[model samples]
Target chain A: MVSHKPVIFVVEPFGGSIRWHNPSLPLIYWDDYAVTRGDGIFESILIRDGHAANLERHAQRFCTSAAALGLPEPILNSWINATQAAIEEFGEGEGKCTWTYSRGRASTGIPTAWVSIQPISDVVLAQREEGVRVMLSERGWSFPSELPAKTLNYAATMATLRLARERGFDDVIFTDPDDGHVLEGATSTVVTVKGDKLRTPYDDTILPGTTQAALFAHAESQGYRCKQKVIDVDYLLAADSVWLVSSTRVAARVRRLGEDKLKAPDNENEIRSLIDAAMTRG
Target chain B: MVSHKPVIFVVEPFGGSIRWHNPSLPLIYWDDYAVTRGDGIFESILIRDGHAANLERHAQRFCTSAAALGLPEPILNSWINATQAAIEEFGEGEGKCTWTYSRGRASTGIPTAWVSIQPISDVVLAQREEGVRVMLSERGWSFPSELPAKTLNYAATMATLRLARERGFDDVIFTDPDDGHVLEGATSTVVTVKGDKLRTPYDDTILPGTTQAALFAHAESQGYRCKQKVIDVDYLLAADSVWLVSSTRVAARVRRLGEDKLKAPDNENEIRSLIDAAMTRG
Candidate 1:
């Protein structure tokens, strides 16, 4: 049996209209800043029940990310339309979608923007079910505050993940080199639960996690207190439960931090149910 | 009048063969890690006197960078031949060539590699002649030692340059945020000259600059003392001359660091001549 490719769309200049694009053909030039310098912004969103989850929040963050990079204000209508079209074609129950907005070709100032939708893979499901063993790695330096854009510059992150895999772990969480405080996971925001409190690292040193924020709101409605602060290693290790949360992988419980093993929290099923409800509602 | 485009070539898998590719057409897919995650490495070399300057040194650094990213070891012969072919077609005199090797599409584990040659723009020449007004900006954080690679994660670099331009400067010199010491330029290495001494910061915290290394070698043969050490603001301000050296720009003298104006040193021409000799010989 032949496999079907994911749905992809390319948005025109000034966010005019998005064109259905062939995934097999090339879509960007060599001189585009996206590839040449990784000078652009992107967002990954979760699709569920034929709808994009928390798209508004993702779009807002996408705009903020673009602004940080001095990119033009994105046309939300165009992006929303493209996302909807892609999902409609994908015919999905569960999948992930991503939007890439680049600085365009060197010769032309027009931006290159695209959206792609793909079904969620089995590995992600397995990660959710079995949990992940994680290691702590320092992200030595930080980007200056003046340009606090989470642009497409993830070489260090990827390298750190590779280092973790080599060391026989499922993922890695980055710590601030200066103070040994938790920053984030390679591709997710980290949250720790202690009793009724849900704590995540402060957004000052990392990208604000859309899924985490949504889950926090839902948990708060369920009488769970939520706070964002500087998280140290000891605080993480002492938590009753820890989760690596992102758009696609809604919540993957951390089974281990370093050599210390962690057990599932007493309310693990309840928390998962809350996350599902939050994502589905959004 | 219709304008001509730069020469570009795409390398086949395993560096088998290179085909001249049209710069106007899209050459990379949306899902390629080069664009998605900046999971790649690149090197820029200066083309001079009908040949690529310091081809062997650049290739060596390329391999080192690839290793840092856990990329497949580069085929040196293939890269060299492609560089020669591109130089031959570019047809002599003052140009810049870059090689980009990226982790390929998400579905395929094969790598994507390409070469492109473009003429040096007049703005670069102007910066060299008139000198640049540089502002000091802190890079805030550093990457961990295990992943000490200079991949195509240039978003911060480009943003820093943009911040400088907005503040009425030509470029930026990034300082280590923790201690307020010099790191390097946004795209080049920092070198300061006082009397007959040449000093650049130690390479441990930054990408080892190939141009700075070559220049120091040539300067040493010419009886100029060279040292690599931690450089503070006071030391940088007190230098008789400061230069930002790189592959494409060769050496751009810094006329102003922050608000303090500086005069061109007595042996500026002699130093330029030495640089020319070093590059031509290589």
Candidate 2:
């Protein structure tokens, strides 16, 4: 009955073999701390033409996230091999491949690792092609010495997105509560473009964006000056254009921030090409 | 091979019958949002003498947490029933019973719910009996209007505990980053005792602790003045005695808060008995 369901590959005991199972089958112990305490780290990468974009970078960030949680260091080669296995099965076209590394059952002390592929939805594609209207929500805190890890504890992120959707927006831009410094999007990194230079928020408070980094690296090589600093909301508001970038959505221009309308990216085609080039580069 | 493993009961769906499965048999989908995004709500209650303590209160808080995440309203009766089933199987003695409800697979829109029972570890019992030495860790944020929800997104909570443990402390009391107000413990609620008054931080910024609430009620009924206020670190430091209260732990006396020694609760026996009576009342 579940033959048609997509299968996820489990990486057995980091640096070990891989096994595939149908999604319908139970795959995680009930007491796995990932589900019990959100005690885990994860990474998602965009796949195009059977290629997993930024796999290396994503894997590095995966390790960084694990370090943040004090989890045992992940065997990067195992993750890469497993992600590739999933992507290979996904074949051509755009899909999102996510790596979930969970602190397994407390008694076991072993970690549960798996990779699953999901097709990018029409809504996401539309947002990528057009733009997204966003609302500003407060993250309610700041980390001056370390960025929040890209952990599986994303309840706030999910809630923020729900809040925006309820208000008739596609996503949200989180602003620091103490000061209205534009932090990042609910699931993506915030980027602003003004004239010749491209800018994004750089601080110990935001998750360092994998897609943003890739895009910036490509853009910088292409002679599009890029800068990262603590960004004020006003600066974003006054920017020539804005975009929310991530592994799957790639780069979705911000059509509206709150009630204020935002201009489309001045170099839309160039920006798309740069992102595509970066994604395809690997 | 897994016959001796503890079993977890899955609620077929809210308002449906339950089925038990061994934890080793894998009870959750790999993509369940509870693991994927930590998008879920859960509750843990102390099971004493075959009774699930203050279950009604736990269920209510469970609903509150679900509401915070904009999840479908839980059918509380099913949770209560499932919890009772697990506790009954545990039978005669103290244990920890946890209820987990995840916003199931996105495609299904059906929430996944389950209950599991665990024997409370001796370390926890010792903490409850001998008191805990705690350190103050900054929560790194302030929520003045709405207390953080007890959601599945507990990466920060787990990380905080890890940090405390690394420093050789049993637990941590989080202080408001903005003003150093005493907040709550990573997995427990903070309470202070001074003279005859029992006080705990009261605000939208802390989880409304179920055990703490029950303790306060029992204490109030006994003519011990109980106050809920926005307590400061100074107040807790000057407190004659302090406690970190939770479901399974009941009320653990704070032997030390940072470097300062705390006097053992003048009414230690009374406090323990009061907590026991409240748990037994249900």
Candidate 3:
């Protein structure tokens, strides 16, 4: 029996329409932007119940990123419909839909785009439950206040994560390249809870973590005195609890930060209860 | 009569064999590193007359970058053989061989690699003659030392170039995110000539430009002093000549740096003569 891979819907280089990915064929030109430059912007949205969660926000952020990268921005509805096409083909029960928009083939230099939907991997799902241990890399460098949040370029980010993993940690945290202060996780935002307040770095150095934003709002609603401010390394080390949150992994409490084992809050389940509700809702 | 496009060769995820890209097929998996995470490092070499210029140097740099990214070292011989395969299949007069060493399919997460050879674009060729106008964008920050040069991720680099082009410049130069000192070009290294000496940045903040290295060596052999040291913005502007050097463009003289339109040297052709010899040899 022939096996059908998950559908990878692609738009023509000029962004006319969407078509299903052919398992028996090559969809992109050999010199497509996806191959040559990785010169594109992408967004990954969680698909729950045949619907893209936080899609409107994701759509806006994607457009912002695309605009920042100066790639042609796809109409917001095109993403929804294309993602729908992927979902219809995948028969989704909790999957992810990723969209890549680029200036088409590197040879022809036209503009094209695509979206792919697949079930979230078990390793990713496992992080939500098991939490994660993270080490800090002094590579505090970050893109300036401008530039897109996420682009196809994950080299430095993934490299940092790989270094952490090799050193027996789950992920690596990038601190401020100058001040030695905390900046962000390889793929998530760092949030800390200390005393009666929850705080995260307020600067634009990192991808404004979508999950973190939702959690911040929820925390405020819970009257936990949330603040978006500079998070120094000393304060982070002294925090009662720290979590790295993103769309996928949802929230992975940092079981350990560097060599020091962080202590979990006595009411850890209560905080998690809030995280689950925030991730799904706001 | 069907017209065949340029060939794009792909390797299996396990890096066993190579095959020609079929127009009627998919070259990459739905979950390939190119598609999902862009979790890969790559190297591009200029090929002329069946020769890959600076092959050994590019290979060594790739290994250094791969190691920095904490990836399995791709056997150096594999790259050479693959380049040969791509060259033979493409029958290259003047093209480039691009090898992407990826952590492989995002699903199974096995290591995958591929190579493609295509004629260098006319835009790149054009830059060699007409020179280029560059605008400074301090936003294009990179990691300090020890990251791969040609990572699949290129958001910030491309974005700054876009911004510069929008403002009616050919390319963008990156500057120190903190001090606003010049760093490097989007895809090239900054080399300036002052008095009897050739100087470029010695620091680890930028990629070691292969073409720049060759040119510097050629300069030294010709009895010119060369130095790799910090290049401040003031020094850059005061230099007699400044050029952006890379593998493909080789060396494009900077006609305009920001608002200042600098005059070209009387012996510009002499410099070009030296660049040509340097590119083909060292």
Highest DockQ: which candidate? Answer: 1
Q: TM for chain B in all models?
A: 0.96, 0.93, 0.91
Better of 1 and 2 by TM-score: 1
A best-first ranking of the candidates according to their lDDT comes to 1, 2, 3
The residue pairs found clashing in candidate 3 are A13-A111, A25-B25, A25-B26, A26-B25, A26-B26, A140-A175, A140-A177, A153-B153
- Across B34-132, the per-residue lDDT of candidate 3 in tens digits comes to 645667778878887778887878888888867776668777666677678777877738786777777766656677677777677778889888899
Question: C-alpha displacement of A117 in model 2, angstroms?
Answer: 2.0
Q: Where is the poorest 10-residue window by lDDT in model 2 chain B?
A: B140-149
Q: Which candidate leads the pack in lDDT? A: 1
**Candidate 1 docking DockQ:** 0.76
Full ranking by TM-score: 1, 2, 3
Where is model 3 chain A poorest over a 10-residue stretch in terms of lDDT?
A: A23-32
Q: What value does the lDDT take at residue B93 in candidate 1?
A: 74
| Pick by DockQ: 2 or 3, better one | 2
How well does model 2 score by local distance difference test?
A: 0.80
Better candidate by TM-score, 1 or 3: 1
lDDT of 1 by residue, B1-282 (tens): 213248887887594698888888899987899999999999999987778887777888999999999999988777777777887777757778999999989878889998898888888989878889999987775655666666898887888788899999999998877788898999999999998899999747787888888888888988999989999879988998899999889888999999988888898888777777777776
Interface root-mean-square deviation for each candidate? 1.5, 2.9, 3.0
lDDT of 2 by residue, A87-134 (tens): 777666778888888888888889888888878877988998888999
lDDT accuracy of residue B177 in candidate 3: 64
TM-score of 2: 0.94
